[model samples]
Target chain A: MALNVNVLREEFPILHQEVNNKPLIYLDSAASSQKPRAVMQAMDHYYETANANVHRGAHTLGDRATQSYEAVRDTVATFINAKSRQEIIWTKGTTEAMNLLASGLSQSWQAGDEVIVSRMEHHANIVPWQMAAERTGAIVKVLEINDKGELRMEQLDELISERTKVIAIGHVSNVLGTINPVKEIIAKAKAKGIVTIIDGAQAVPHFKVDVQDLDCDFYAFSSHKLFGPTGLGVLYGKQARLEALPPYQGGGEMIERVSFEGTTFNKLPYKFEAGTPAIAEVVGLGAAIKYLESQDRSAIEAHEQALLKRAEELAADIPGLRVIGEASNKVPVLSFVMDGLHPSDLGTLLDQQGIGIRTGHHCAMPLMEAFKVPGTARASFAFYNTLEEVEALFAGLAKIQRMFT
Target chain B: MSLPNLETFKNNPYGTETAIDDVLENFEFLDDWEERYSYIIDLGKSLPEFPESEKIEANYVHGCQSQVWLIHMQDPADGKIYLMIDSDAIIVKGLAAVVLCILNAKTASEITNTDVEAIFEQMDLIRHISPTRGNGLRSMIELVKSIASQQ
Candidate 1:
C-alpha cells in the first residue's frame, strides 16, 4: 500500500511554505518533528473552548478538560502497549523522565553499585545517570560500541556484575539510527535482577514500539518527536515499578491529603505529575497519536526506508562523503561527514537552499568521540517526507560540494 | 584544505575586502536575505590560511556550532595583539575573519574599550545568525577580552 505523499504533505501547513524563496525541505525531524494541522487544530480547540485547570474544577469546561486529559493516558497506554493506563506518567520530555527515574532510583542503590549505559546514548540519558552516581557513590559502567556503531553484546556480561542496579540505554541511536537489540539486552538484565530503561525518543516516531513486548521496566519518549507539540513526553513504567518508586516532585495535585504534620502522596501516575500540567500539549499529543493511528504505519515505514536508500545511494557517489552508520535494521536517519567539509558547513549551505538538517554532536558527544569526528550532518525522515525532498537534499549537498571542495 | 592566501587576499582583487564601512554598506545595499547570505559566504573567501599545527586541542574553543580555534600573540614593538583565528565551517571562518579584521593589531586597552557587539548589531547580522553561532561569536570576543584583561 503506497501512501500518497502529496496528500500527507498537505496535512502539515508549515511544510508548504517557501523558506529562502524555495520550498521547505525539513530533514531535522529527529530533533523535533513538525506538527500537522490535526495536532495544531486540536491544541487550538482545547485552548478555545475547554480551557480549565483539570481534575479540580466542577464546572462544564473543567469536566471537559479533565475527561479529555485523562483519556489521553489511555491513548498513551495503548500507543506503547503498556499493561495499564496508570503506568503512563506525563513528563516534560525524555530528559525529565530519565532524570526523575535516576534521582529516585539512586536513593536506594548502595555505594559501589553499578549502573550500565552505552556510548551511543544522548546526553539526556548519560548526564542523569552521572548525576545520580555522583550523589549516591554508585558506579557507572559504559558498554562500548563496535566500529560498525552496534553495541558490543559480547562485553555485556563483564559490565553487568552482581552489584548492577540499573541498565539504561537508547532504543535507537540518535546519531547512528541503529535499532538496538533492547529485548535481548532487557532479558539479560532481567535475569540478573537489574532494572532496565529504554530511551525510545528516537525509535517511537518511526516504528511500532510495545513496552510490554520489549519487557523493559520503563520506556520513555517525547511527544514532539511523534508529530505532536513540545513540552510533553510519555514515561511508561510497569505498574509495580511505579508503585515502588517514590515521587520525584512535591506540589499540588500529586498529594492525596495534606496536613500541617504530614502529607500523603496521590495514586499512580499522579504521584509523578505535580502541579498544573501542559494540558493543551497533552491534547495535541492525543490528536497526534490519533492521526498516526489513521495512517498505514507499515506503508509509512517502507516509504521512509526508500528515502534512506535514495539518500545513501547519492552519498556513495560524492567523492569524499562518508556515510556514518550502516546498521542492518535502522530508521530513516542518514548522517555523514565529507572529507574536506565540516558538518556545520554542510548544514549551513543546505539551510540556504531551504533544506533543514541537523549538524553537530547531536547531544551525543560520546558517540562523536567514539566515531572520531567533531559532528555529523544528519538527515532524518518522517513518514510524510517525500522522495522529491530527498532529491532536494541531494541537490543541496551537491551544491555544497561544488562551492566548498 | 585551507582558507585564502593572505598575500592575494590583502591585494583586494575582488574589492571584497571586509572593511567595517565596506561590510556595512554592502549589507545595507543587499535588501534580501538570500543575497545577504551569499555575500557572507563570499566574506569567508578572504580569511588568511590557517596552519595545521595550530589546530591542536589547547587552542580549540568550545560552545561553537563549528570547530573554532584562536591563537594570539602580543607584538613587542607596538604593544598590540596579533590574533589568528580559524574554523572548520566556512561561514564561521568568515565570521572569524570579520572579528579578526576589527580587533587585530589593537592594544589591550583599545580592545577592552571597543564595543564589537554593537558593530555586529549595527550590521543587522544578529537576527540572521543562529543562537549557537551567536554564542560562538560572543565566546570568541570573550576569549580576546580575557586575554587583554590578563595583560
Candidate 2:
C-alpha cells in the first residue's frame, strides 16, 4: 500500500496547532522528530495500562513491561541486523550513549594511542573523545572536511595507523546532512585492527542502517530523531567489544555482584545499562519501529528527496541567500546564510510566520569555524515535511532577504 | 521619536520554574515584540546572586551574546559548590539565574552526578527558549560542570 504521510500527520495533534497565529511548519527533524500518533498512543497506552519497571519485578505488570521493553530491543537488533539483543544497550540519548563508550574505553587508551574523528562531528561526539583523550595520553586526530562538508577519506586513511585505537565518525553530518562513507571508513579502520564508532544520530532515522553490513564496532542514535520518544536512545556494540570494555557506571542493575572489596559486572548489554530504563519510551520506540516498518521505506525516502530538491531550487533563487552545504550526497538538511541579518534575528522573524528552523552552529561549531561564518540557519526535513512547507520557508526567507538587502 | 522604555519591561515567570503557566500560557498574550523583549529581559533580571570578584576574565562564558561571569566557591565544610554568576545582558542574567538554582548549592559530586534531565523537566525551560538560547543555556551548564570538575 502507498503510505500517505499526510494521512499519518493527523495522528500528531501537535502538528495542527497554530504557532504565532500561523500554522506550524516544523523543519528541524535533525534536532528531534515529531512523534506520530501511533508512537504517541503507544506511549500513552504504556502509561495507562502497563506502567511498570522491567526485568526485575516478579509481578504481572513487570512481566508485561519487560516484554514490551525487550520487544523494542528485538526490533532494534533486527532493524540494524545486530547479532543479538545482547548487543543493544539503552541510554538517555545519543550523547550519553557516545559518552558511555568513551568512559568505558578510556581506561584502555594510553597517552600515545590515537583516536580519529572528523571536523564535522556534533559536540556530543567530539567532546566525549576529547575528554577521554585528556584522561589518557591519547591523541585526537581530526579528519578534515571539504567546503561541501564531505569527509576527506584519503585524509582519514593517512591519519589511521598502528597506534590508532578508535575511529569515531558521524554517519551523517547533522549540520550539513552529508552522508559519510562509513563502510569505507570502517574498512580502512579494520585493516589497522582499530575499533570504529559511528554517530548515527542523523543517519539511522533518515536512512536504513544495517550494522552487519557496515561492520562498525559501535553505533549510537537517539530514539527521538527516528520518530520515537525522547530520553531514550540505542547503542549497538559488537558483543565482544562490549565485553572487553569496562562498565560505564557503578549502579544498581549493571552489577552481577557487589562486595565491600570490589564489584563483579553483569553480562554484555546489562553491564552498560545501569539503573531504571525509560520503559514507556522504549515501548513507544517499539511502536515507532513497527509504524515505520508498516510504511513503504523507499516511498518515504523518495518523498524527502523531492522536498530537498524543491528546497534547493527555491533557496538558490533568493537573492542574498546562500545554501551552506552543496554536496552531491545529502539528506534534506539545508543550512543557509543571508546577506546581512544575524541568525538569531532571522530565527525570530521566522518564528513570527510559525515556521521553525534551527539557527546557529547546529552544534558543529568547528564546521562553522571551518566555513568562516558566525552560524547558519539550518532547516532539516523528515518524511512528513512537504514541498508546500518548503515554499512557506522560502517565502519567509524572501521577506528577511528583502529587509536585509 | 519615542522608543520603548527598558525599565518598564517586566519578566513574566512563564517558562522559568516560577512561571504562572495558567495566566500566560502562550507568548502571544503579550501585545507586541517590544513587550516580549521587555519580558525576556525582565526574566534575565531575576538571576540569582553572582559574586562581583568572580566577574574576572576567568569566569567569562565564551559563547554568550553578553559578557557573563561565573565563580564557583566550594564550601569547605560540606564540599558543595556555591556558584555566583552575572551577565551584561538581562536575558542572559535570567538564564544564569535559572542555572544557579538548579546547580548551585549542590556538592561537587551532586553537580557531577545529578541527572540534568530531571531539572530541565521540572523547569520546563527548553521548549520556551529560542534554540540558540537553549544551546547557550546548555553551554552555561557545561561551563558550571567544568568548574565543579576543577573544584
- List the global CA lDDT of all models: 0.86, 0.79
What would the per-residue lDDT of candidate 1 be over residues B35-136, giving only the tens digit for each residue? 665676677776666677778888888754676788777767677776777777777777666677677767899889877777778866653244556226
Model 1 alpha-carbon drift over 4 Å, by segment: B1-18, B22-46, B49-60, B71-81, B106-135, B142-151
Categorize the docking of model 2: incorrect
Query: Which segments of candidate 2 are over 4 A away from where they belong?
Result: A1-3, B1-151
Superposition error at A295 for model 2 (Å): 0.9
- Judge the docking of candidate 1 as incorrect, acceptable, medium or high: acceptable
Question: Each model's TM-score?
Answer: 0.90, 0.77
Predicted candidate 1 versus true structure: per-residue lDDT over A275-325, tens digit per residue: 999999999999999999899999999999999999888888888888888
Evaluated on chain B only, candidate 1 has a TM-score of 0.79
Can you list each candidate's DockQ? Answer: 0.43, 0.05
Error of 2 at A86 (Å): 0.6
